[model samples]
Target: MHYRLEHADLSLILALVRGRSLARAAGLLKVDVSTVFRSVRRLEAALGRQLFEKSRAGYLPTSLAQSLAEQAERAEQALEAACVSLEQGGEVISGTVRLTCTASVLHVLLLPALARFMPAYPALTLELSTSNDFANLNRRDADIALRLTDSPPEHLVGRCLGTVSYRVCASPAYLSTAALGDLERLAWIAPDDFLPDHPSVSWRRQRFPGVVPNYRCNSMLSVAELARAGLGIAVLPDFMSGEQQGLQSLADVPPSYDTALWLLTRPDCRALRSVVTLFDELARAIRLGHAGGIPA
Candidate 1:
């Protein structure tokens, strides 16, 4: 009666049957250990049969699992063929992948990466939504996501893509009229999300060293705009100021402190070929794009 086979869930079952341990199965699947545990439970619930019996030592395959093992093998092959049909059309690979990310990444990093991806995979169409808000993975709102955090939510699985570091930056014209000593006299624009009232803003406040701004604004775009208009000095992620004309790094921020940029998926959703293929391609694009050099 287990006619329902979600590709990702089915793969987890196959991995468990082969490895006999959730931890080991997760490793082979390139996902965290917790993800393997949840998938196994979901599989049990859906099939109404216990596939594995866990002991202190390891998992023992149930008679039911033994009976279904061969069928699972067939299912795996079917999933593979389905992926080929969805992502590749002869020479071209195409699918619609939706992603949620921060404004900073949407503008600075992803734009260029996609330009590279499109030429490589012309069949692919990307739907990117950017905001400070985090999407609920349980709702299946986004097929993939990029976040500025290290660990993912309990039900999600992912890896840190890279680090985002900040530096003190100012315009060429403003730098001429001002000095670091003019700290007290300078105007500063700060994102409300990173303001003193917010808990996450603690690091930003510590980094400024008493330099308060003449003007205040919220969001990265506003900060970039104000800096472009010759408003005042502000601490910005290096990539933001790197490409803009008026902005220049006033001081090389030591890289010791950095925030992680992560790539993620709903743990259960990983089984979908559409999601898996896109996640892999995007991760590759981000990695290769970084090696080429961070976009200005």
Candidate 2:
């Protein structure tokens, strides 16, 4: 085995290992699926070892593949650290800050904060990536992230914004003819398996055992939209549902579910003035319930 792996090869392997699907890996790499497939095939041929096994469940990494992927992740982290080091040495406080969070959070929380912060620091540019998946702070996929978690990752440092609360909401049209006594009997729009561990899901399971939702969606925004359209009642964050038109919270379903909101940043990136300033502003906005531009 005289083969030497390149950074590109390692990156492909890492993407495949993490994404678990050719399409997903391609998306992450900003390439086509054919490109990913060809690259993986070439790497496997060069190493004379199978990296992944394909099945209906998607690509499963072999032991060697996992080891290589881990190395690639380490390399990524090191590169990010180096970048942060260089950023810290610079005196300029203006630059692009990449931020990531769930779509709901971006719209409900960060958007208002951003509206205020961006104008104040006109020289600062923001790149926002909204998704349900947690961005890899270690890889610098995002410079900052707003997350709702009970236990924040040890590797990251930031401030706890506040406690996020959820409530069951529905449109007035739907509630007019709806049965409010038995929650299990009401039409429900629930989060899909992607959010299986969400507080709302857990609350629903505990409150209405063995009950199935009438509709299910992966996006919290979609669930809220469907509820607002009179499709069904949805469990939504207070910030998301509070100011929506024609939507009313069910008094029967008390605000019993809550989670901690965190403004997280990589330790190395914390030294950057832009990151620190943004982090402080976001923390303040969230703590004061000012992020949504409405009273909490």
Among these predictions, the greatest TM-score belongs to 2
Scored by Cα lDDT, where does model 1 land? Answer: 0.68
Q: Rate the local accuracy (lDDT) of all candidates.
A: 0.68, 0.80
TM-score of each: 0.59, 0.64
lDDT of 2 by residue, 1-296 (tens): 77988999999999999999999999999999999999999889999999999999999999999999989986886566556557666433466688989888887778877787666554566788876555567678998888888677777877777767788888988888888887678899999998999888998888888889999999888888899899888888777776454578884334457777777888788678878887777877767242321111
* Per-residue lDDT of 176 in model 2: 88
- Number of the top lDDT candidate: 2
Q: Which stretches of candidate 1 lie over 4 Å from their true place?
A: 1-92, 136-138, 193-200, 207-212, 243-246, 252-256, 288-296
Clashes of each: 6, 0
The local lDDT score (0 to 100) that residue 58 gets in candidate 2 is 98
Per-residue alpha-carbon lDDT of candidate 1 for residues 1-296, written as tens digits (9 for 90 to 100)? 64576667656777888888887898879999988888788778888879899898788888877767756776665555567666765533445667888776787778778777566654455677875545644567787887766445756777666677776678877777776674545777666545444222444566666755566666676777788777777777666776454688866556655566777887675766667777776677775123221211
Q: Distance (Å) between predicted and true CA of 43, model 2?
A: 36
